[model samples]
Target chain A: MRKIIFLISLAVVSICSVTTLSAQGIQEKSLTLHHGSIKEIHSTLPTCITVANDGSDAIEIVFPANVEPYLEIEIDKRDDILSFDVIDESITHRELNAVLQKNPIRVRMSTAVLSDILNTSDMSITFEDGSVGEWFQVINTGTLFVNGEVLAAKKKIEYYNTGTFTSKIHSYNTTILCLTNTGFLYTNGYTTAKYVEQSSTGIENTDLKVACEKLSISTTGSGVIKYEGTVDDVEIVSTGRAKILTSKLN
Target chain B: MKRLLIFAVSLIVAIAECSAQQSIDELLNREIDSGTTVFKMAVKRDPETGEIIKRVKEFTTTGNKQLAKEFVEAFESERDNVDGWEENRNGGVVQITAVWVNPKRIYTITVAGSALSVFTQTIYREEDKKSK
Candidate 1:
């Protein structure tokens, strides 16, 4: 029988190469929600969770690109509002401990060991709403944005010194906005810059017009970012509110 | 060779008598302000008041009429602990401000065209405010 069709075609090519390597692996999903029970987990890559709560309460874990009907989670009992949807293999763990022996809340979902945004260089963005821009222009180097989104240029810097300027400095505790070398404004705490031509040989003019909500310019040189709201060219900028337009608002 | 030129003039008088008592918190040498242009200076201390709060100096001089006559001879050699002094001239630019009191100090000098710059700031006059 032609060797039984070559052993059933090598067992159907070994079960189609183990179902195509488990559908291109990297899918973790874990769950552990007690205290009223509302658990669910699902992943296809892009996870980083650690919700360890039991004592010393203080637990707030909401992830899924942070809500937007994208797996909505807003549970703060006793004000009476319960909305739920996380059914993926329908509740287990003894039916989530019989619904956490009548709602107590102890969630423990897994699958979030992520850390490979090209091995991270450092990124910190926080804009529950928006605001960042009084004056902005940071030519290049390990991006930094405050008052919410306006940064994304992970790596690709070149300017071996036509006059030095290197980047990889990120330290923000917050005091409003202030990022200079020639751009980024808004500061209502303590701002001081007195570099009257600090040893110039040329090209160090730091042009400024000022007014911002959340600005960060310099896509590549002669930066003159004027904004009223929205003008995509790159580097995170969205959800308006940026002043500083004495002129250039046509 | 005249005893090697008197042993190289006694090794330049023993390195100018070991730098004639250096210290202005040291570091200021191009043979001690020759043509000047020294930058990057420090001497800050105050890890919870260990004193010597500051002394951040920066220098630059391109002759500027000999560093404005050596900064008016370093503000007239700290004229009796200079309690206050100021000089400002427009047009060819020249600025000098001084304030010193024993260990506390602040001296600034600026001159244009041919450039000349200097700043020395240090404060922390304690020791029971020196009997005052």
Candidate 2:
């Protein structure tokens, strides 16, 4: 009887260990936000977030399962629109991966998360008042308007400009490219307008006022680019009636 | 006597140009020995005109703050020899861009933060084109 009991105990221990190991592995969880709902995300720790739009009426957020224990989800109905406040309560340093889809949302991240990377497409994100980061990349077709002070080290913005893109980016290196159709881009700070390549039928009107160390502008469309800044070295290439005006060269 | 005076003036100009070029070469040698070349580009020219347009080369010293400071000081020491010099500071970052122009070419040096960039632009002379 004692020998049989020992074998059963060993089997139970092995099963428990396997279950704990599986739970510690990577897993995912998905949550849905109703259409036109306002979702505000706040993280206590540094987090990397990627946001995109799929034209769905509801907003979907898929996050790593490990972060679920640290998350606090609250929803309230105000003026017929649901508002969600998702707060991260982790105190230790861990990378929280949150991928959001569809609908517009507001995010407020602290300076500890400044080194985090933000990737966005086909959606609108408004940086609250004063937000800083190391890298922010915008690609594909959509509108991105940042009405705040964003101090970053590098930014690469590719705007199809189905809508307007206006931001104040203070970065050491910045590259802006406007492609297809017509749109407006306005920016101010220390800018090195690396290359602005436009198609034949594309019209992108850009106005930039910056203190530039090196300015390189190239355009091949009917776009008008007006620049005002203190420039050290400049190389301008324009064709097809693209108007380029600079305070120093104009 | 007029010919002799002109020859003396030309000799002085040649000596000055040689010394300036030698200093630049020495700085480049030191950079090669101590720093790492992060980026480099050869001189580019217009296809039809064959006129040299631009060349860019950049070097970094990893995270050695002392070596970076030494490079910045060495570049600043050449400010008096260049035609134009401008320095802009934002927070902890410093940017220095200088232009040196001669009868045959234009050179620009830009130092942003710890990286040093050098650009060269060749001036197209009428006599040289005719000879070609």
Candidate 3:
């Protein structure tokens, strides 16, 4: 599993460069979804789906103080995703084929200590600005304009590094490993993260998935998101590195 | 000697961990330019000729269909729109003065000599449309 993930991560690192594209001259198509999150098969539907946190830089969801946020079950269809950077800006979104995008989501996990991140325990989210946080999964990657510079963070990043650079990082409170790519793998009272390969080929794949989950951020004070980047097929979360796999959801 | 070996190994792991960090630029990594919507115009077939024009003449329609209807007016309006509107925005309603069907392409398009093309996409409402 680890081997597969490493290869994928290496590949993702390369593709990450040209991820942003323009939505030029596209005929404006307005969509309306009844719910919050929408999930579908990509082959059947290739509709564009954007997200909005209403009008806030972050979407606020106050779950039970200790309750973790899971995959937003229902896929939402809306004419526009609310742009938070602006007071009242709207974004055009489309319905993504689940197969193409895989299942990217935003989950709320508990927070760990700085020691955990420094220790490289489980997953780690190291930001270019040196701000670190943790999560279980990323929903989408969005542009982060810090101090006036725009950066790209891939969406649905399960595991990755601070991208050859960083000053800030985010780590989660969970032990990091939940379900392995092959079967159920757990991290019991240890900082070390291991992979359980369902098949020999999945060694890297399993490890990468585990790391992604480890590095994922829990949008607690701020909502967690796995954003679709300017380019299709890639999602960004908080302007960070994201390594994804094509395995079916368990 | 053993402690020194452990320290060296630990240093390598730390260096490897640090190497993973990239100068991933998030700021200025925007999706669109100025969040501005762009508009373009083109000419279709000369209605009198009733002959189809080449693909380069106008923008292609997005959906799948074949043998669409031919028209002339769709072009004129778009030309005017391009000359007039300083800016176009998403969700903003712009008229497609000249819209002709590309029978061969099986789609609708903003003909040349027309204004900005306005797509007639549906909006999803929670309640029934009849109620609204």
Candidate 4:
């Protein structure tokens, strides 16, 4: 009797989910990119995530909002190729794959679920490519602190996105001869950008600047910051070679 | 002239040092210019010697089924010495290991929806041991 009751309940749940998915017309999508080369990653899923060449070998990707649980994620590898599939049997594979390749993976889940996915899911690696063969190492060069929260890279391009994002330089004796308008830097999220030196050695001669509303910096190394654009408020903590150009901070 | 010469030498040294420190397999994987980060590859390094033992690359498709299928086709084209492959339906993942005995190299590829990780390692061959 108990077994029969359990089976009936399972059937009812399955039927309800199928009916709900049909009503919403959720689709299945798969995305594939060569493992070695990834350049720019931008999404229009209302949740904007931008990433660049910061060396990270493994990163979790985000799908649209609350659809995390209902969705089935599959990673298929054969030969040397890898395929990422977001399965929603209700939708056609052809249509879903096309959309994912072109834009962000969006699902028509409830807004509440969207909030949960954004807040809980630690999906990362928005962009990747071979511009820097080992961007994972480059990105790990330092720990960026934005308003006391740690920040990870969102998008990496050969050129800086000058007007949109602010990039923090944590490299040793790195020189940006000049900053062009190719691509700028942005925080992991919209927050005050800062740097926390994680290396035992000090960082030196890092020429960096940004155009943002509020900027906070804290570093325990020998590094110099040059602001190339306007800013509203700035706070800095320095230890060894840490200095911000007072003349340019205004 | 002296300063220019010093700068040139320094640049060459720096480039050489960077190349020497990185594994050739990692360099090869890093050279590809595909625009997605879902796929990942790694190498197994010996603990005491710090030498690379093998290389493995793994990737997944999340919204482009055709591209994923095509990529698999392309990858299989270069299967020089695949020892074995297994497909699991539980999560629809695949694990393939290719071994080249002469070169003493091993490649293991694994793909799961949440993770796609591959690794490669070069092993000491029995032939080398027998010759010694």
Give the TM-score (vs. native) of candidate 1: 0.25
My TM-score estimates for the predictions, one after another, are 0.25, 0.33, 0.17, 0.25
Query: Candidate 2's residue-wise lDDT over A1-250, tens digit each?
Result: 5332111121222222211112335455555544332233323222323333333444444445455554443322222212222344453223332332311223222221232222223233444322233333333233455444443334443334434555555532445432343445544444454443333234556566654445555445555656665444445444445565553321
Q: State the lDDT at A9 in candidate 2.
A: 22
On a 0 to 1 TM-score scale, where does candidate 3 land against the true structure?
Answer: 0.17
Could you give the fnat of all candidates in order? 0.00, 0.00, 0.00, 0.00
Residue B25, model 3: lDDT of: 10
DockQ of 3: 0.01
Worst-scoring 10-residue span by lDDT in model 3 chain B = B24-33
Candidate 1 deviation (Cα RMSD): 22.2
Whole-model Cα lDDT of every candidate shown, in order: 0.33, 0.43, 0.22, 0.33
List model 3 lDDT by residue over A1-250, tens digit each. 5332111111222222222211433222121223232121111111122223232222221111111111112221232122111011232123222221222211211211111111111112222221122323321112111110111222111222221112122221233322211111211111122211111101111222222211222111111112111110111121112222222111
Among these predictions, the greatest TM-score belongs to: 2
Off by over 4 Å in 1: A1-126, A129-146, A149-171, A174-250, B1-43, B49-52, B63-123, B126-132
Question: How well is each residue in B6-94 modelled by candidate 1, as lDDT tens digits?
Answer: 99999986665343323322333331222123343444444454444554555554645864665656565655446687888899887
CAPRI category for model 3: incorrect
* Prediction 3: B-chain TM-score: 0.19
> Distance (Å) between predicted and true CA of A155, model 2?
7.7
Instruction: Encode model 1's per-residue lDDT on A1-250: one tens digit a residue.
Output: 4432111121222222211111224222222222332122222212222322223222233222211112223332322122223323454334433332332222232211111111011112232221112222222222222232221122211111132232222222222233333322222211122111111222222232222222332222222223322111112211112221212211
